[model samples]
Each structure stands twice: as structure tokens, then as C-alpha cells.
Target chain A: MPHLIVEYSSNLEGFPEAHALDALNATIIASGQVQYEQDLKSRTIRTEQFVIGNDPTALRGFVHAELRLLAGRTPEVKRDLSERIAAVLRELTPHPEGMLVQLSVDIVDMDRAAYYKGTL
Target chain B: MPHLIVEYSSNLEGFPEAHALDALNATIIASGQVQYEQDLKSRTIRTEQFVIGNDPTALRGFVHAELRLLAGRTPEVKRDLSERIAAVLRELTPHPEGMLVQLSVDIVDMDRAAYYKGTL
Candidate 1:
């Protein structure tokens, strides 16, 4: 199972979340790393409030993504995937007039043993 | 760095996100796990669209949280913290009639060496 969770600052008013999400999904599918494309779950969360480096007055924003996959991949794979995802996010986020937007991508490993899929 | 990110189902008509966020921060502070309470930034993301187990008709919702902490803590500490956070989320989310809500908490370790603080 793979899940992509994106959290972006509210300051990025013009960002296209849904489009970026689809692009991310496409990137993952193109990687050929997943068993089934339909099983990939992706969602976004807008951060209404945030601060950067102790400066509330600073015009700063961020777009952070977390990609969680069932455990099995080596550390190298995670690293490469994270870098690619970061590039996707960075490209998608616009460099507005005066705001600083930090983009980050984190690759997470979900425990395989505890992971379950069944009817509830 | 410590950040609490909560992603919940938008179906929770009456779920108090801001208030529940405060309670979660209080719970973490009470745990005495972090160095500074001020550094702990909490935020919520509402999931507008989601599917549960290939069933579009299923009346189900979920509130999943990710607590990102700087690397150093032992697995035991992370597990205990996750459990406490889960409890807080469950207590805060209302069990609306006929809908099932799943609560989950994930403790993530952020690489300390790569973490940086800077002014732009």
C-alpha cells in the first residue's frame, strides 16, 4: 500500500492542489514501483497557520509531502523517490512575489506485518 | 523539530478541529517529551474526498495524525506517544450515528543532521 499526504500553507492561494496531486500520482505510476495504481491513495491538507524560524511577520509558506509505503524497499529506493517527489512539489509550487515557500518530501515506511486490508 | 499534522474526514460535521488541536498539544506537553512547548506546531487538514476499502457506499470516516519529531528518541517513547495521541484523537472525534471513524497516529523521526533553521 502507498499513500501520499500533502500539507501546504494557506498562503499559497493560487496553488492547484488537485492537479498537483494527479501529477504526483502519475509520477508514482510511471515509476513502476507499485503493484496496482488504483491502490495508491493521495490526499492534501491545507495548513491554516504556520511559522518559519521564529518570525511571525515573515511572509513564508511551505508545501510538504509524505509518501508512506508498505515496508520492503531499501533505503536507496526511498531516497530516490523522495528526491523526485520533492522536485515535483518544488516545480508545482510557484515563486510568488515576496513569499518564501519551502518544499519538502518525506519517504515513510509503513510496517508490513501490521498492515491489513479487509472488509470492516 | 516537532509538528503535529491531523488529517480528518470532512464528513465530521461537528468535529472541533481547533479545540481538539489544543487538547492534543496539551496532552503532548503533559507528556514532557519535547524540549519546548512553543516549538510544537500543530495543524489540521480536512480530507474532502476519500474512499474506504473499494466501497464508495460505505459510511466511514477517519482521522489520522502524524507527529514528526527530531531523531533520537527510542522506539518505546515513540510507541507510547503514538498511543496517547490516538486516545486524544478518539476522544475528540465524535462518533456520529451510523458512521465508522478510524483513528490512527504515526510517530515519524526527522533526520537531525539534515534539519536546519535559517532566515531568508
Candidate 2:
């Protein structure tokens, strides 16, 4: 399984609102790209806001997302997940003509990183 | 400075093609967001591909990008850099309506991570 981390940055806001998060979760589950009942049952996803641009006048803000998906590393699978997540973000946040928004994905090697262990 | 890592995934290929990487680097230098002469000059950005979806019949392929930007922890800067990078990517890789591409940025805390040095 591949632990996929999707982070998005754009000059927008008002995310994780109402059923947005739920919608994302549902989409992931329905896609069957992940094991909603097992591997992805307790996965964590976070969204935050940030600013960019040289001159403050250039661009305004950006919304970022971090999604952790547990799965094996396969070129094809990674591509699919990346597209699905991007499609969802585009739908969620519509940008203006000149405005800019970006999405980045990180496929983490779970074995290399240590997961949290509950205290004894 | 913020070490910004931008990762992009999409159903596309032929990236880092010829002067593409050079163009990206030049744009970053002109942006003035990073001290290209110093703090921003020596940085790394990597791009890769991955696949997603289950049906294998529904949707396929994705191009991913990972960029490292170094700057202070500021919201505005992150947003601008994200948009600029995305704009560049969009221009570079024109995707089809159905094809999905994603970009995720990770602002790494340089102090917490160690930089490699030539040791005896």
C-alpha cells in the first residue's frame, strides 16, 4: 500500500466547510482506490491556509491539504489517486482567471517513517 | 526563508523537457520571493509520475511534482509561490479535460532537518 499525501495551495479559502470533508472522504471510499474499511479506515487528512508571491499585491492566499493514504507504490495507482484528488479540489475551489492554485502529492514510504504508537 | 517542496501528479509526461526546468528556475529567481543569489539559489525540486483508481477501467495516469522552497513561515508567501508554480506547471503540461493532475507543496523546517556536508 502507498501512503499518499496530497497538499494543495491556492489563493482561496472556505474549505473543510459543511460536508466538504465528508464529500472528500466519501469520494475516496467510493473510488475503491483505498481500503475504507481497513487501510484507510483511520487515516488522517488536514487542511490549512498560507500566503505566497513576491509582492503582496501579486497574489493573495492559498488553501493547502495533506492527505495520508495507505497503499502499495505503483505508478498507475499513484497517477489515478493524484488525478482524483486534483479533480475534487478543482471542483471545490473555483479560481479566477488570473488567480493561481496548485496541488502537490507526496507518496511516502511508510516503512521508512515511524507511525505513532500509543503509550504503554 | 521557507523550504517549500512542491509535488505535482497528473496523467501527462515529457516534463523537464529541454529548457522547461531552466524556465522554472529563471522564473523563481526573477520572482524575488527567494534570495536567488543566496538562500534560494541552491535548492532542489523533483518531479515524478504515479497512477490512481481501482476499476482500471475508470480514469488512469497522473504526473507528480515535488518542489522545495525555503523561507519564513508566512501564509502569503506560500500562497504566491504555490500559484506561480502551478501556473508554470499548467502552462508546461496542458492536460485534457478528463485527465487529472495534482500538485502538493510541503514547507519544510530546515533547522529541524540536517543538510548534507562533505566530511573527511
Candidate 3:
């Protein structure tokens, strides 16, 4: 199971959050990476209070994503997944006029033994 | 820079998101871990859409946290930080009484060389 969390600045007006999630889930499912539809739980968060670097008045914005997966996939598969994710991220590049847009994606793998999934 | 993200289920009502961040920041600063006050960027996201395991109607909830840091601190330091974080997480123990509360913390260190800090 992989968890994807996308955090973006509030000023970004053109970022299609819901559409991007749909595309990502579709892409991941197409890759045959996950077995079930609900295996991937993704969410987005709007970062209203944040300080980017040292500039207090830089008029900057960022959309950063983190995907955590249980250790099993090869490095190449992860790279491919991240590349696809970055492609989706690029769709919102230069979202707001006259603002610096920072887009980044990180793919992380948790140890299979340490990662635990349980039901109530 | 270390980014802290706390994701909790909507069912958990007693988790004071703002308060927990304040305490975490204070604890990290009190430990003399970071040089600047703004070095830490944290945000909370309420998971309104999520599926826990295979249970569709379990009345379950989870409070998961991720702390991402640059690679410089020793394992002992990271362990200490996680322990302190877990302690803070425990403050809201049995948060809403009956529902199962899954609490977890993950301390991840990124390669210092790969980490970049920039301004617009």
C-alpha cells in the first residue's frame, strides 16, 4: 500500500487537485502496481501558513508531493512512478501569474517488516 | 529544513492540531535541534476520504505523522526526537473514547546533498 499526500500553497489558483488525484490513481492502477482500488489512500492539504526559504515577501508558491510505499517495488519502478507524478505536477506549473512555482515529488519506501496494516 | 505533516481521521475530535504543533515546535527548539525558528514547516490535514484496511464500517480512525529532516543528525538524536514526539502524541490518548485510535510517527532523513533550499 502507498500513501500519497500533496501539499500546495493556497495562492495557487489553477491547481486542479481533484483531477490530479483521479489521474494519479488511474496511472498507478494502470501500471499494475496495486491490487485493490482502495489500496491507495491519497489526500491533499493546503498549506496556508508557511515560510519559504528566507524571503518574507517573495510571492512564492509550492506544490510538493510525498508518496510512501511499502518496500517491494524496484528502484526503476519507483523512478517511473515519480516521473509520471512529476508530469502531473507540471500541469500546474506557472499556475498563478508573476509567482514563483516550486514543484517537487518524493518517493519513499518503508521497510516491509516495520510497516504495519491492521483492521479494527 | 524538516517538514512535519500530521494526518488524522475526521472521527478523532480531541486532537488539537494547532496545540500539538505548538508543543512540537517548542520541544524541538528546547532541544536545540534547529538553528532558526522557521526551519520547521508543519501542517495538519484531516483525512475526510480514507479507507482503513478492508473494513468499510469499522468506526476506526488514525493519527499518522511524518517528520522529514535533512541528513545530519545522529540516530540517537533522531530516536530522541521521535520519542519526544510520541510523548506529545500520547497527550491525546483515547482521544474520542470508543473508536480505535492508531497513532504512529515516522522520522525520515533525506540526503543533505540532495536537499536544496532556494528563494524566488
Candidate 4:
């Protein structure tokens, strides 16, 4: 199981939520590395306060995603996944006059022993 | 560099923001496993919509924290860090009647080559 947390800077406008979610879900499904598409949990969070580099006043926007997956995938697969996610974000986020943007994706392993899920 | 992302359900009331942050920062600093206290980036995000287990209708709340650090830390250190973070969250989060609360922490390794931080 993998949970994708999408964190975007609140300074940005016109975020394509549906398109980005569909693209990411499709990317993971098409990779054939996941057990099921249903298991892929995705959520987006807009951060009002964030620091990029040292300049907080600069017109900067970022789309940072964290993907938590069950341990076992090879390093190559994780790297590829992170790169692909970043690429999708770069394509989806809008750019306006005097704005700088950065995109990053992190693929982290989940320890099955520590993770607990109860019946809903 | 390590980044700690705290994601908490928005439905919960009276979240102890200052206490949680200080406790976490202090926990990491006291562990002596990190390069420096300044190197740890901590941020809190309130999620508007989140699903735990299966039923979305249940009045359930969760505090999920993700810790990303350089890839050389031992497994023991990571586990200890995760547990300590979870314990701090449990102590800090307020519990109301009829609310099912769960706390979880994840410690993830960062690939130094892939993680990019520009001049701030």
C-alpha cells in the first residue's frame, strides 16, 4: 500500500486537482508495481507558511509530494516513481509573471511492523 | 537534512501546536542522531478530508508524521525516533468524547543524491 501526500504552496493559483490526481493514480497503476489502484491513497494539502531556500518574500511556489510505500521495491523503481511524479507536477502547475516554482517527490518505505490499521 | 511533516485531521479540536512542535524538535535534538537542530525542518498541515481504515463516517482522528533524513542512520535509531515521536503526539493531542484517535509516525531515509536544496 502506498499513500501519496501532495503539498503545494498556497501562493500558487489554478491548481488542477482532478487532473493531477488522475495522472498520478494512472502513473502508479500503469507502472504495474502496485498491488491495486484502490490502495493508492492521495491527498493534497496547501501550506500557507513555507520557506524555500532563504528568501521567504520571493514569489516562489512548490509542489512537494511524499509517497509512502510498503518495503520491498527496488531502488530503481522508487527513483523512477519519484521522477515521474515530479514531472507530472511540473506539467500541471501554472506559472505567472514573476513567479519561481520548484517540484520535488519523495518515495519513503513503510515499515509493516509499525503501521497499524483497524477496522473502519 | 531532515524534514518532519505533521499531518493531523482537521476535525479535531484544540490541537496543541506549540507544545507538539517543541516536543518534536527537542526529541530529535536530544537523540543526538541528527546533524543539527537547525537542519530539521518541521511543518504542520491540517487536512480537510482524510480517510482512516474504511469507514469515512466514523469520528476518527490521526496524527501522522513523516521524518525524512539522510540514508545512513541505523534501523534502531529510526525505530526509536518513530516511537518517541508517536509517544509525544499521544501525550500532546487532546481527546474528546466519541472520538477515535490514533497516532503514527514514519521515519524515512532520504537519498542524498536525489534530494535537492538550492541556495536559500
Q: Which ten residues in a row have the lowest lDDT in candidate 1 chain B?
A: B111-120
Q: What is the C-alpha lDDT of each candidate?
A: 0.77, 0.44, 0.72, 0.75
Task: Report per-candidate DockQ.
Answer: 0.12, 0.03, 0.11, 0.11
Give a tens-digit lDDT track for model 3, residues B1-120: 567777788888766876777777666666677776556666677778877889876778888888888778899999888888778877853467567788888988864432334323
Model 1 residue A36 lDDT? Answer: 88
User: If ranked by lDDT, best first, what sequence of candidates would result?
Assistant: 1, 4, 3, 2
TM per prediction: 0.60, 0.41, 0.57, 0.59
Whole-model alpha-carbon lDDT for candidate 2: 0.44
Sorting all predicted structures by DockQ, with the top scorer first, yields 1, 4, 3, 2
Interface RMSD of 4: 5.3
In candidate 4 the C-alpha lDDT for residue B81 amounts to 84
Candidate 3 fnat reads: 0.06
lDDT of 2 by residue, A18-120 (tens): 3545555666666776643334432323323233433334443333333454335465655555456555655765464565444333333344255552324
Off by over 4 Å in 3: A1-6, A11-45, A48-120, B53-58, B92-94
Candidate 4 regions off by >4 Å? A6-42, A46-67, A73-108, A111-120, B114-120
Best by TM-score: 1
For candidate 2, give the docking quality class from DockQ: incorrect
Supply every candidate's count of residue pairs whose N, Cα or C atoms clash at under 3 angstroms. Answer: 0, 56, 0, 2
Docking class of 3: incorrect
Model 2 lDDT per residue over B1-120, tens place: 222333334245444432443455556657676653222211222334444765666554443334454225477766766566666666776465675555444444331121211100
